[model samples]
Target chain A: MTSHPHPAPTEAGALPGSLLIRNLRKEYRAGQPVLKDISLAVEGRGITAIIGPSGTGKSTLIRCINRLVDPTSGEIWFGGSDLARLRGRSLRMARRRIGMVFQEYNLVERLSVIENVLCGRLGYVPAWRAFLRRFPDSDVERAFALLDAVGLGADFATRRADQLSGGQRQRVGIARAVMQDPALVLADEPTSSLDPKTSVEIMELMAALSAGGGTPIVINIHNVDLARRFAQRVIGMSRGEVVFDGPPDALEDRHLTDIYGGEGWLS
Target chain B: MSEAALSGPSRRWVRFTPVERGARALVYVLTAVAVIWSLRTIEIIPEFLYDAPEQTADLFVRMWPFDWAFYPKAVHAALIETLHTATLGTLLALVLAIPFSFLAARNFTRSGPLNWIAQFVFVSSRSVNSLIWALLFVAIFGPGPLAGTLAIAFRSIGFVGKLFGEALEEAQQGPIEALTAAGAPRSMILVKGYWPQVEPAFWSVALLRWDINIRESAVLGLVGAGGIGVALDAALNNLYWDQVGLILAVIFAVVIATEFVTSFIRSRIL
Candidate 1:
């Protein structure tokens, strides 16, 4: 853990997708900070898991990266721009390079699966084109191919998103993020609502896809074991602060106790 | 100590406080008094009351011999005009209310003054009855289907806009957030996110409003705007009770038919 509160000029420009969060702070209410001065460096490639107890601001931290939840004061350096200060058109253009997945698989329930997957290209395509569902042929093909890669075949493409099972929906969600051709993907509790088996499958699928595309992924996950299994690096958080940052092997039982603050559930 | 406490006395749970119980009793008394006082003030004539059934029977007797001949010349055309007015008015209301609904929807627009203006329009439209709207439009447009259509459209704007706005507000933010995070513009997010979620609700509201407009439009002709009500009004003025009865029957049938059609369509859409 370098703990560099500032992004070194040399490393900042070194990678296309590398993220440098410097002294990030968020206060929903005056004098009450939910995220207090968080700083982290995520490399341009591979999976980085953020594991913490509920309400510890792991989701907030990941959201701040993509400007989903604005940081009160900080600098998020990505794609050679300050993601923190980006506004309006610039912000939207910057967001085109960062994709996101949600725990609920947040697809438009009434929309067809293919369209849901194609939604990732909404930023690149004109509004009227998206409205008319006249996505470019290349994007359509990429969407279908991503669907297949996520294990949803051509048969599932025409079906409504709501018709799919939890695992199937998550697959579509992953396909959508991949369809963005993003340099970075942020997943907020991507497997929190799934069953244990499905959760493991989703994690494996995410790992393989990110590795295949070399798109760096930062996941906010509650499952420590999944993080340890799938992530190259794990950052442990407690009470809105990063308490541990290292390889998964370095995350010891004592560290878990410190992160979650209870020994009863450790066993 | 625990055994003694358990055996001592059972606690009582009262549903309401003494003040609340007294208030409820007072409300009942006030309602009864208001009903009695209103009844006493609007005195019914004893002679008219005694002749009411006889008069009704005589009126029915006069209306009995049906006006089948009048259907082709007047009733049919007026009926068609009424339907056209209702359909057109409903369409116009839908088109106008859609933008207003988006404006009023807190989640969609996020502007306080715009929401207030939209809400004010809805309130003003709803406050004036369709008949009153017909009267106003009749003054400006001078008594025709156009006035009737305008009245129906104006009255329905509030009903459609308020309900559709609520539906837009109720749409889950998750999908919208997902679209926003995907770097989609505001319009794209609306197209992909809000539109899909609100489509069914929009259809349901539109159909319900159209059904109501049919009934309202039928009566607009009484105010000299063109519909079946105008025919009925003419029949009433000329002492043509039979034509009036026929028109009433037609209105009743059309209203019931529209109710069935709207409900069926609503069930399918929902």
Candidate 2:
């Protein structure tokens, strides 16, 4: 598939979001913890890459923001509410402004590409209408535009997500997330399954999304080089704690050795 | 080539361990003993087998001389009754099973005691034969078409609920989670995420059971629960072999018709 590289999202006004996490903690077992007393704030605008070795707390931290994996103890302040304490309708409303992308693409395999993209509006639309596929004309048109903006042609709209290549599926995933008109986008290992070239393409697409709008992205990634190439700010984690936090240029071999604990893999 | 491979079939290279061989021998011996014991207990005799063909031939001879005229009114009404019993029973069972299956499905219910109760209902319904269910319903409801319809519905809950429950459990979890993250309501999750995935399977199970119910309900009249089987029972009691043959023929035709309709619908829709 050729890259069309259409223009950025311009229809929906960009409402950049701010997030502040205070003393976030998650313990799966009684004593052992996956994330420990971590605090970080993402102001707005630009991609914030979280690079760490496998089994670290990078994924946990990202998931906690959306309350997918509830934090053991913390305050998640986003859009004038504590995301940790919200329940039921309030939680859902808070989540509508926050969009998330997964490692697996996670599009409903049986649904067509257009329907999957329109799923982003499920929070706003009434249940009956959504179930009946009676999405408003404006929503449908915007979904098509989002698909087009992601370099997928109009023909791809009717195709099933499973029929596409890995790269194409990721494109749909991006389209779905942006379709939410989100303030914050959380991505968990979005490119770990793709080839090197496709990985770069995914990163480029995400970067353009962050740049065009003021939406901030916290991507948990393992590819350090890709993170450096794409991320404006990089936060490195080791043993469930952030060991280094700085701009990409400020990060060095010493910090890599500290975060990953290796000298041989750097060269 | 090795000597073993060249001398024998390739399968010779694979051998059962001594424990496996011993278990196999023990199983064979036990099965042989059990079969012999059961045959003796049931009083199997060579004399019955010798007379079987003769008796069948006598009955077959008596069933000749087509009673086609008897089927015009009496047999036709009974056949329609049987169809009604089956169709209404299936609709009732399908409606009842939808909620029970949710309780039984691991993903939907998630409650240990409720799941156990749902499983219990399914098992009990399935364990009783349709004839036995008709007998029970007749005792409670006083031997009418009402009894027959209720019997069919109760008997089918197990079949429909168990299949539909398994369908719910087999649905893909990824889309479910995606819907949850999008903050869709619980009902919406079911409507959009789960229903589409399981719609074809639900229809297939219901159609199969409807075809079977047609056959089962045709005989419920033996217990005076109503339907064409009542006509069948009356014929058999008076030793009216020709009338019996007519009823049997009508039942055979109806069953085949129902099978054709269900399969055609299944093929077209699914």
RMSD of 1: 2.7
lDDT of 2 by residue, A140-225 (tens): 99999999999999999999887999999989988988888889999999999899999999999999999987689989899999
A1-267 in candidate 1: lDDT tens per residue? Answer: 145455544553466889888889998887888899998888988999999899999988988888889999988988877888889999999998999999999999999999999999998998778877889999999998998898989999999999999999999999998888899999999999999999999999989977888899999999999999999999999998999999999999999998999799988
TM-scores of chain B alone in all candidate structures, in the order given: 0.96, 0.92
What candidate 1 gets wrong by more than 4 Å, as runs, is: A1-13, B1-6
Best candidate (score: lDDT): 1
Instruction: Give model 1's TM-score for chain A to 2 decimal places.
Output: 0.95
Cα lDDT computed for each candidate against the true fold: 0.92, 0.88
Residue A258 lDDT in candidate 2 = 88
Evaluating just chain A, the predictions reach TM-scores of 0.95, 0.93
lDDT (0-100) at residue B229 of candidate 1? Answer: 87
Candidate 2 vs. true structure, TM-score? 0.88
**Which numbered prediction scores highest in TM-score against the true structure?**
1
Pull out the clashing pairs in model 1: none
